[model samples]
Target: MNALPRREAPWAPTALRELRRPWKLATFALGLGWLLYGALNYGIADWDVGISLLMGGLTYLLASWSVGRLAQLRRPDAIGLAVALAALFAAWYCVDGVYVLYHGLAGNRMDREGNFRASLLLYFLAGMIWFYRGGLAELRRDLIRLIPRT
Candidate 1:
């Protein structure tokens, strides 16, 4: 009689096991980069900028937590969580960018014009990249489950 292969149960990975998931690590790094860039370019005195920063920090925390939960039973919902957070951040940036552009058109300080646009672009790019990575990871996991073992 042939022996059947053991099935691996899905459970959140311990801190020691997290390193094995490269996608999670990459997501964390991307979040940190966004946080740092936003901090350096914008002063927190403005309420709009302050709120955006706060949300960015919170999003990073959630992404970190999700990394720990990666091994848990296929939570396709994690991707949705990450995407929602990213969309929120992007919307915030878009609103701020429009406000800044309006002021600039009115002949206000044009010094930070380029910086503002660059920051908005960077945030958008980061969000998209994270979303894409999460999607691909989910798809890969699904594919793995579909393959039959000999």
Candidate 2:
């Protein structure tokens, strides 16, 4: 008897799926909170908090997308270029996070150490890496299954 071909369930893109993660949802919520806080307390002058949060969220999404795209590229030179771009993106985020955290600490009168902001951003960075790896795995698996066997 002949075996039937396997059918897999339809799924969303890896980058979009990353947004559905619990931690990512939390980050979006936190971004909204920052937006609200900045608007109510100090207007556009203090908009950095909200903007940083939004950027952080976008970074996670884009990193996942990058990993997914990287997995599909066939050329060695293209892969190397993609890797370099990804690294540069990550480094930029790190520097931006530090700047945001520094400004946050400078603005806060009561919290001299800025421990809370630092820790929160740190957690988000770790979450971004986690999301990227998860997306890579999922996309690679799908790509592998798409390959035709002789």
Query: Which model scores highest in lDDT?
Result: 2
TM-score of 2: 0.37
Tens-place lDDT digits, model 2, residues 33-133: 76557647764443456445655554544543443434444554754565646644554454355445655766732332453365345544544444433
Per-model TM-score on C-alpha atoms: 0.30, 0.37
Mark the regions of model 1 whose C-alpha exceeds 4 Å error after superposition.
1-25, 30-90, 93-111, 133-150
Model 2: per-residue Cα lDDT at residue 53:
61
Worst 10 residues of 1 by lDDT: 1-10
- After aligning candidate 2 to the native by TM-score, how far in Å is the CA of 28 from where it should be? 2.6
Report the C-alpha lDDT of model 1 over 22-116, residue by residue, as the tens digit: 77456656665665666567554332444445445434333333322332324447654564455455455453554455455655543345545
Q: What is the lDDT of residue 21 in candidate 2?
A: 66
- Measured with C-alpha atoms, the lDDT of residue 83 in candidate 1 is 47
TM-score of 1: 0.30
C-alpha displacement of 66 in model 1, angstroms? 19
